[model samples]
Target chain A: MSTEIAIHIQDIHKEFLLSHSGSASLKTALLWWKRRQLEELKVLRGLTIEVKRGECVALVGRNGAGKSTLLSLLARVYKPTSGTITINGRIAPLLELGAGFHPDLTGQENALFNAMILGLSRKEATARIEPILAFAELEKYRDAPVRTYSSGMLARLGFSIAAHVDADILIVDEVLAVGDFAFERKCFAFIEEFKQKNGTILFVSHDREDVLQVSDRCIWLKDGQVEQEGDPLTVLDAYESGTA
Target chain B: MRSEFQELWRFRELLFAMVERELKIRYKNSVLGFVWSLLMPLATILVMWLVFKVFLRNDTPNFSAYVLAAYLPYQFIQLAVLDSAQSVLISLPVVKKVYFPREILPLASVISNFIHLLLSLPIFFIFLFVIYATYGFEVSPFTWRMLFLPVLLVITFMLTAGMAFIISALNVFYEDVKYAVSLLLYIFFFLTPVMYFSENVFYALKDKPYGMLLYNLYHANPMAMLVTAYKKTLVPMGKIDPGGGEGLIPMLPMNWPMFGVTVAITLAFFFGGYALFNRMKWRFVERP
Candidate 1:
């Protein structure tokens, strides 16, 4: 149906073992290693979901609602403890704001490293190098270390790299918030292009306006379970009305 | 194996990139740059030569050359282990980001140190020529012995890589391991026969079985064997060959058996290190 589901999620679950404090002592570490003393924080309960080809879906939830965790699972960054996720095409993930950047390395060098990490061949990475720099509009500062850039500058470079990655599915996590208003408009434009080209997107956002503006469909996640799902306007209205 | 090789092959460019980064970072903000790589070993060699040969006045043949050869490989070992051990923690920023093969960090350290060693070669040759010209020493025939150099490098690389992977991975859980490895590497420096000869152990042991145990441990050490092979490469025939005299032509071949041992031990270290790193990588994702 519709040339195979782009992403198939069947009853996924995840739980993390968190320490009592921010850091672990030798004693706590030993206990953690032995699994003799620990507290489990269950993040994602039994949840099933799917996204078809050419679909634009928004995952809306409050902080700690497992939106990031679900995206991480899809990206293969974190494995599901008990579920199967079979994704049919290449994945382009803007997992976090400029996660691959080195503080001391130039923005140009970080682009090269980030491209290679995204599964591009070295030559392919080199070919896309100019376009990425141009899109970020940091051609002048491309040779400067990323540490010199503001948060907005770093996000611009990151979003540019993600947009250039050719993939069937683009997993975005509040990437629009990284840049200023101008880049936010750019991200919405990219979303429109992506949808027109029949590319799949799994976007997570806390902004109802952004969700309603870009996503054709939306799912509201409360705690770890799906609270509601349907058209974006109806779902956003329900989520906002209920919370208010 | 093909898949593993494919994984490594894909990351080879990054490996070279990281090696370049390490070399650059090592000399960064320093006036001397990589001159430190040479000066440390050279200074130690001079000190040992002064203490053992000049002051003691009990000169073994080619004593200066013996100390230099011993110290050079030993210095390489010291650096390879220390750098490898710190590679992962040192690149925590990169490791926490988009994934490539993690082995690139340690392997990059190996390659960086190897480059440092390569830089030292011209100086080593210059030393060889100077000693020969001034001290009336003559080099042995450049036979198959020279082939052992590359082999020795591969072995040291493998051993360092393996140990580095294990230590760096462990350091993720325990911050103390950084200091612990520093102390252990210092101890290993003294234990390794870089400054002293293995023959000294044999002479010290004399007839006691305790000496035999020490001898076994000494030979079993991959680093010792590599250093010994390197010494044989640099030591002149006129000095060590019993068959040599005022007119007698000397002939001593390379130690093929020792070379084979080094190769096997190195492969063992590399495979073991790689396997351990693969097993531990997934856990490292959430670690730091």
Candidate 2:
């Protein structure tokens, strides 16, 4: 118990029932009203994994390979259809950049809102307000609605706020590809510092170099299965060769 | 159940932020800004007043005031319902990717419209005062009873928010709901006592005893009760004739019976919306 596992997942499985597009129309709605059948789309199969406190791990998978679904499960965005996750620490999930942001809201407003969504008290978030502005390099545009921002600007703003959140566990998904190279380098530096401070990090990226650079270990997922879990270099080699 | 409400409540700040954004954006690029909130109901009342007084030669007493009272409350209800219905559908990009209380989208619409309602209040009262001064009708002072308006609005809000949650969740699965809502509101307008009065329903249906049917519908419809309550409080209903007091009316006290009905039905809608929303919300992210 003292080992302090930040997250514990055992035998987790998820399945989704997707309806045909015509399910919404009144004609089909009436026809299928009684039958109520949905086409089955099995997005996630049975899987098991865990992460200890202060561990930095990378989750790698191809598109539709269930990496996003797994992250969603871990973040409790979607409850698992089966199995359970015991998460003991505060989780700040940068699940998708700008996910909670309102396009019409100013940058500063979005930051506070994003902070609150990530579970920080308004006052706590407000105290770091200046730092967030400085980090995003959007001090002049803080009052401008995010709609006015470029995708890179939006990503920068999102990354800045996500970085400032105080949490025991952080979950990041494919957002390293956002922003310019300079901003990306800055973000990687932040990730390295966070790793050094013993913050538990879970990230997913198709970029093997990124996985190798930031993660202490890597988990390679293929078709919703954990294909390999080990040092980033070896796992990437195996995943690449296997897919090849 | 407790945890559910706590989870929803804890995210109240997020709701406020979204509401603030909505209000600002709504008024920002426009020349009129907050005036548009006032103008919608004001213009509606002006048009109706002209039609009732000049064209029809209808001698209904304080017709201007009647239009103002009825129109304002109707706008509040309209704004709340329309915004709530679209909340989830519009915020799909955000809600699909992020995890927060899904109810906040519709709830935010309610708050933003409620702010617009607040902005429109001065206009409502100013018109009342103008009618009072010009026609020499004694005006009622601001009273504690006015506090009940918020209570009523809140109930209306919860009802709309819940419906918005349900409709939005449904709309996510069925895109046509977005188009259907506008048409629905068009029919809903006549159903409520917005352009016409409950008296008009009876007048139009007098030969068939249709007024009684309308009265029944009135009792069942929370918005009808609310509009009537607003009339009772704001426009003097000094007389309760069989046909909506054909002439001058005096301010009557708030109708407690209608108030009770409004409260009860609002609760019913809120719970109904909640149950439906909870049942449908899980399917939202996956639907599209």
Candidate 3:
């Protein structure tokens, strides 16, 4: 593993505009034209962290603690209002599985499309179809439209496609929690292999045991700022006792 | 913006996949499938020909060909803009989860519709040939001027893409942008010279004081110029030989100045749309 930084976060601040009413509708938008009130919700406030190359960093936080927001920023899904996030390599973000899948498209077709969107060429994606299908254990149902798929099946397909992307860094946000036990174990095995190959990982999870097993370091977030950061067991202990 | 376009180019494969996905989804679960692309414009041409030729009794020679040349391109723009207006809003899940050039969503819609337009071109040519052979109407032979068809198609594409970018980005905030675009298309359909000829508008108000101004202004619409250019290229005008005899071949009355203006306007629309979209795109992730 290179001793360079894989992910760098510097003084990142993010603010979300909360509309008082459902202003997307033209009627409400017109009605609120003059008196519209927008509440700015600061999700992240001057928070900064860095993950070295080949490091597995777990982000553990309660609901609404900005875990998802921080991951989204790292994935470049949203720009920070006032700070910077620098990622040195290609990113494969397993945020919400099947979020880009067209429900009307068949599993095979959706997999091809999703893989291409994730940065694989058509030839590369086609070459990996067999392995992807095998990993998802969904070879028989490849022809069915995803609308007919169960949530678990959809997650499996999404995970399979994302896992195949040739990426230097992987960002996982609670996606493994939706899979079956065997699938979760398979995902961890793949993560272990990925770690062995010196791939950097940033993950958000509520599962304490999974975090301790997968991550060498942990960052505990509270009220949109880092509450603790150290070895996984130490931070987890501090986070648990602080919450309790 | 240059880097943005470069990034989009790097993800060109994704753009192509998105376009393929859209085309596939549109035809899925349908019996006729891609044939609908041909049948739709053909059906519209048929009804338009009937109303103009039989009901209204408008005696425009080669009426089917004329209506088709204008209507096909107009339909392409209409469908592209309308569909793309909702592209960002419809892909909210992907927009919020994944990180790629956000412009690719609406651009994919525009490209798919451009493919549909390309497919329908053969139908237009067939209509021209049929009308020329059966009705004894003089049809222009393929000429260097015919090369302008691709140029016209590209301009139409750029114009539609620009509008799509602006409308789709706005749609992330105001859902009414889609309806507004539909309403604009409805009104714009009449403003362009699809149903009538630019010459007729000129001839009708020839004696008025501001007749020439109105005439020039009417033809100044970029869409009208495109439609007229398409008609000139496809629908031929009977020309007289110097020997006081009617010529069998047709000639196009090329309007180079109007075309230049249309090209300029299209470039403006393309750049303006991108400017507006890039400016408003940051708010997209913050929207619900």
Candidate topping lDDT? 3
Model 2 clashing-pair count: 4
Question: Model 2, A203-227: lDDT tens per residue?
Answer: 9888888988888889988777788
In DockQ terms, which candidate is top? 3
Q: Given candidate 2, what's the lDDT at residue A78?
A: 84
Candidate 1 accuracy as TM-score:
0.88
Candidate 2 whole-model C-alpha lDDT, 0 to 1: 0.75
User: Which runs of model 1 end up more than 4 angstroms from their true locations?
Assistant: A1-4, A21-36, A95-97, A242-244, B27-32, B56-58, B90-97, B141-143, B237-265
lDDT of each: 0.75, 0.75, 0.83
Winner on lDDT between 1 and 3 is 3
lDDT of 2 at B66: 65
Candidate 1 per-residue lDDT, tens place, A1-244, comes to: 3456899888898887765455543545666554544568788888899899889999987888899888878877676879888898889887366886777788888887787677776788889989999988889999888899998889889888888877788988887676778878887898799889989999998887888788889998888889999999998989889877
**Cα misplacement distance, residue B92 of candidate 3 (Å):** 1.3
* All candidates: TM-score: 0.88, 0.90, 0.94
TM-score of 3: 0.94
Q: Candidate 2: where are CA atoms >4 Å away? A: A1-3, A19-28, A31-38, A95-97, B138-148, B202-214, B239-259
- Candidate 2, pairs of clashing residues: B236-B250, B236-B251, B237-B250, B238-B250
Q: Give the best candidate by TM-score.
A: 3
